[model samples]
Target: MATGWLCHELYMWHNTGNWAQVFPPGLTVQPGTHAENPETKRRFRNLVEVSGLLNHLVQISPRPATPDEIARVHTREHIAHIKALSDAGGGDASWLTPLGAGSYEIALLAAGGAIAAGEGVVSGEVTNAYALIRPPGHHAQPNLAMGFCLFSNAAVAIRHLQARLGVGRVATVDWDVHHGNGTQAIFYEDPTVLTISLHQENLYPPNSGSISENGTGRGLGFNLNIPLPPGSGAAAYRAAFERVVIPALHRFKPELIVVPSGFDASGVDPLGRMMLSSGAYRELTHLLLSAARELCGGRILMTHEGGYSEMYVPYCGVAVLEELSGVKTHVDDPWQPLMMAWGGQDLQPHQSLVIDKVAALVARIS
Candidate 1:
């Protein structure tokens, strides 16, 4: 039950300059902390230490991904653009995605962290691992950086596993509240990788993650998007997994399972409109672990993604780590009781309809 953990002090140093959450401060807008700041990730690491869970986990050191490694998933121009911006002392990577000096190097480190975690699981160095790296990468694309992401960390890691480690049939289950557009696009036409994203419908990136946006060419039906309605909760998510996610994984039978884990789907996150609690995340982790055990030799690698609630992200992270490591701490999520009791925590008929549609797509995965 060895769970590999990766974090670097420099991860917190990737500066996203002072801007109101996702916007540059102006006369009309007040300057405040950016939504993707370091506090959430730093606090998550700290809580792991405070909860004594860090002691039970194996630490994995991360190296900066080589330009060639990043090129596996990103274009040379896009890579050069980020480096130039960082060299010029920081600028926006794309719409609303900003970075500061040395951010290019930090982004490389984040991608490397993801690769390290995947290597740990694939090499049997750890049963499963979680890389709590910063500057979330799910929203990044091959040529453009969007949301708060620079490099598509999960995509880079998956490419590394396939091209370098001789692994095949990798599946990514992204429950990040926002569409994993980048990861989806990277493997959209490739049948070897199954990309499943359970996100809020049309929340970010505008008009993306529709049920019809499955996959194209040979990859059709291999990509699944369960766009749960806003305010979806534990019941909706559980239904999606049992009816869509787990079934797809079983059909695909991936050699490794990658999770773009994000806590923004939690009840307290400012960016998302969902109502999931820490308990819900624990349940989801349990389900994924069971599926991995049966389908992928129990190899699961989770790379950190969008989660803005500094206060609550730590609890949600700990819950997942506890399940991953089979170690429980005395710390309890004080927000669970309230979040679980909130309205719309049960599965609505509308949510069921969405899940049913996505469930049908699972049959297409050969």
Candidate 2:
């Protein structure tokens, strides 16, 4: 039986006050209406309200990740720049990412939740944990913040383990629709960590996660990219995991597993064209948990990444939690009609050939 740990900050500190409609340059914020929360943070927090997940895992209280911890992965100059922006009453520093008055504290808690979850796994407190953090962290790099991400949560946790705890070998598997360019950039030169990204090609960062751009120097063959074509579903993901991620984990023999979980791959989500259903998350969770159990005594922690659809993200997250904690709260989906409206037929050979090509590409990446 696997123990489950959760960071309790899911409902706390999410878009408390109303945000202004007008954003700074290059900032694309959801139009603020009096009726809607309008902030993605608030929308993402809907997962906490799902009774199924709220009752499954134990919520461990988390404190803010200290400045030293933040500096482990991020440049000190970049940290100072973010603080300066927040201190000057919030501004957009390119890439549609906004910083409000409480941005610093919220971002700290997000990072802290991730670190605490990692600590839980490292100390044998839990076999696997899920950190339901916000201001999703995978897109934030060493110096640039983008795609609604602030601090690089997964990178900070990995670096903390490396610098302080002396846990050298870690594996970061990013399952977001967009590539984890920030994490790849941070560990591209180091051999201590292996980064695998499964995302849409040419989606967010524009030509970022190509299979050719593996890694340089000592990190060669340590980075793997599987850019599933748009509209690839469970067939593609399951095939990728069986043929790619599983073999990579077996070869790398990581000390722990870190997942940047993103639900935007759901078919109804606006972020990507993938057609995965809620059940796919459960299978993915089970597969990773199996890997952790077989390799690292089930030491795994997943940090929330990017999932923008308010209606579907919560359900997708709840499904993963249900599978992880072994708790079935059995809350039926009220929006199945909405899903039925757009849920197309199963991924066909038109899809299988693409998946076959992806499998061959993944085989070469390994």
- Candidate 1 versus the native: TM-score? 0.99
- Give candidate 2's TM-score: 0.87
- lDDT string, candidate 2, 1-366, tens digits: 455555544324434233333233225655442111233434444554556466546666667899889888787887787777777777664556766666777788889888888887787777778887766788888878776677899999888877777787899889888999988988887777889898877787887988766778988777888877787777678877887788788777889999999887888776688866677777888898889889898778889887757777777777777777777765665644454355343455665554455445444333
* Candidate 2: stretches off by over 4 Å: 1-53, 334-366
TM-score per candidate, in order? 0.99, 0.87
Give the C-alpha miss distance for residue 310 in model 2, angstroms: 0.7
Q: Quantify how close model 2 is to the true structure by its C-alpha RMSD in Å.
A: 3.6
Residue 134 deviation, candidate 1, in Å? Answer: 1.4
Alpha-carbon error at 43 in model 2, in Å?
6.4
Clashing pairs in 1: none
Q: Give per-residue CA lDDT, model 1, range 121-145, as digits (tens).
A: 9999999999999778999999999
User: By lDDT, who's the top model here?
Assistant: 1
Indicate the worst ten consecutive residues by lDDT in candidate 2.
32-41
